[model samples]
Target: MKRDVADFWNLLWEATLGLCALFALLNLFAPPQDLPWVPLDLNRPIGSATGTKVAAFDIARTAAPDQVEATTEACMAALRGADVQVERAEDTDDGGFCQVRGAVRITGGDVTPLSPSVVMTCPLAVRYVLWDRQVLRPAATEVMGSDVARVDNLGTYSCRRVYGSVDASARPSEHARANALDVAGLTLEDGRKVTLLGDWDGAGPAGGDGAVLLKRLRDGACRVFSTVLTPDYNDAHKDHFHLDAASYRLCATGPSRTRRAAADSESG
Candidate 1:
């Protein structure tokens, strides 16, 4: 009995070692986004380690002052390596809870330009570029039968608590620190306009091409952004998609009961 138990333990140990070796070998050829230890590359496709790595950038806002600068530098390095142009904005404190640190205004270079440009945190900017490249562009071509020309956004920085919150003690929104983007519309190369309020439900019950394209964009945002609030989330969000790179993650598409009934009712 003792020999049998010893043999079982030995086999398990050897198997674990073998699996670890295989994993390491595979990771050698995998993209940087797939390897946890590897630094993040904004140009790479989203992979196993992408979420965790991107989340690390949020430390720029949530960590100590020293760490915030370090995290900001690392994030900017990733963006620069991806050939994205950025101009760092001076840090600002509103004399209250809202403060913007290590924020940047994406200037130009290998990125889709935003309409009425606004400044944003490094993490948010990185995720926006990724979303534009990997999600919005592809979905537009595949579903809308056109390429995206410009992304129209409502705004970025607002020194206020969460919208509709009556409590003065309510947590400050990501916008308060320029860590969020309120995506309002997309103008396609073919000159068609798609807006969250108009095309969220699409043209039919099963949804038309516009609805499919919008949903795809939403789903793609969820993969890269830590927080994604769609119109289905509530009336307050009925006109735009709220995407953010906060420390916490939440994909608030809608209520559970409604979701259970029609799973395809909303965005990411």
Candidate 2:
């Protein structure tokens, strides 16, 4: 009986060691992006954890303000490593609702230029470039049969409350801190301009290539931006795609729920 017990224990130990070895082998061979615990690298292809990693930096701004600087530097380093051209913006605090930190103006870097140049927080910039390279450009080529030359924007940073509420007690918007981007239209290589207002659902959902391209961009944006408010959200957003990396966890694809959580984080 003692020999039998000893044999069973030895078998169990061997099985445990084998499992550990298998996992180690898998981790060694897997792509960096495929691993959730792997640190985010802009140079790498977008993986399943890319969105969560990007969102974490914005959340860190509120949850642990002290860590913001370090995260921002790390994020910028990742961008530089990827050969993205960016210039640091001067930090500013309005002594009131608006404050900009770890922000940068994205210039030419294998990315489509933004019309009427705008600055964005580093995290959002990362998402922007990724969306441009991985999602936007490819989608445009596939659907529009043209390369994207420039992206028309409403703006990036504006010190204001949510929905531009005039009341002092109102929750501040992500734009109050250069953390949001309002994309209105896109200019194609073939000189075709597509605007959300005119083309989003312009052809009965999927009739025209223009409408299809808009829908594709919107869907791809949802994958990266923590909060993406589109025309389907409300009349106010009827003209542009509101993409932001705010702490609020919302996609606003069809107005499923109003975001109250952002009010708390936007207080910073």
Candidate 3:
């Protein structure tokens, strides 16, 4: 009986030590089965047109072929749904910018090319603020009382990192990775030029239309993108509206003084 009791205690001790060893091994070498840091927004329903399917993940640094096809389809579909005419679609490796295209006039004018900056892995997270100027036509007509024309691009695919004291080591900008775009200006059919730096704050002849249209565009962008930064947001965004798929929050800023208050809250 004494021997049996001693044997039982020995077995219990071994079991406890085994459990401790197992936990230590798990902590040291095992890959996590669940990720608590990455939060997914499943609110947007997945939809695709006949030719392509919607991407399952955000457009990141590396993109799969199917992801590219899906994102291209989504962008084209959005343009088409807004009645924009796509002149042509071409693939280009302009510093990680994929699938550059020339989308012609849907707002009644000569053909113009629309170059989009789309990233690979994060297909939904694009770097440019693309507008189907066809969609902007009615808004421009209603707001500015004129026939709107072309949407201009400042530049796309710059191989630089984010500005300010963010990070160093020369990481690619959203544009370089085809995740961001910069809009320098726009030209109308009536010979009106609305440049971002020149006309954003009612400074040029196209100021009124530019301001109104930019506001509307920013608002619209918030609905599609997870993050939208406009001229009124901060000095860092004094020129163009920065739109991206951040997956956490949506921000829309306008010319109103209230924009400052909104920015404070957004950053917090």
Q: What does candidate 1's lDDT look like per residue over 210-242, in tens digits?
A: 778878888899998988998888777888899
Q: Please list the C-alpha lDDT of all candidates, in the order they appear.
A: 0.83, 0.81, 0.49
Mind giving the per-residue lDDT tens digits that candidate 2 earns over 123-166?
Answer: 89989988888788999999988999999999988989998899
**Candidate 3 error regions (>4 Å):** 1-130, 133-135, 164-166, 169-172, 207-209, 246-268
- Give the winner by lDDT: 1 or 3: 1
lDDT of 2: 0.81
Q: TM-score of each candidate? A: 0.82, 0.81, 0.51
Q: Which one is best on TM-score?
A: 1
Better of 2 and 3 by TM-score: 2
Between prediction 1 and prediction 2, which has the larger TM-score? 1
User: What C-alpha lDDT, on a 0 to 100 scale, does residue 51 get in candidate 2?
Assistant: 77
User: Which is the leading candidate under lDDT?
Assistant: 1
The alpha-carbon RMSD values of the candidates against the true structure, listed in the order shown, are 5.7, 7.2, 13.2
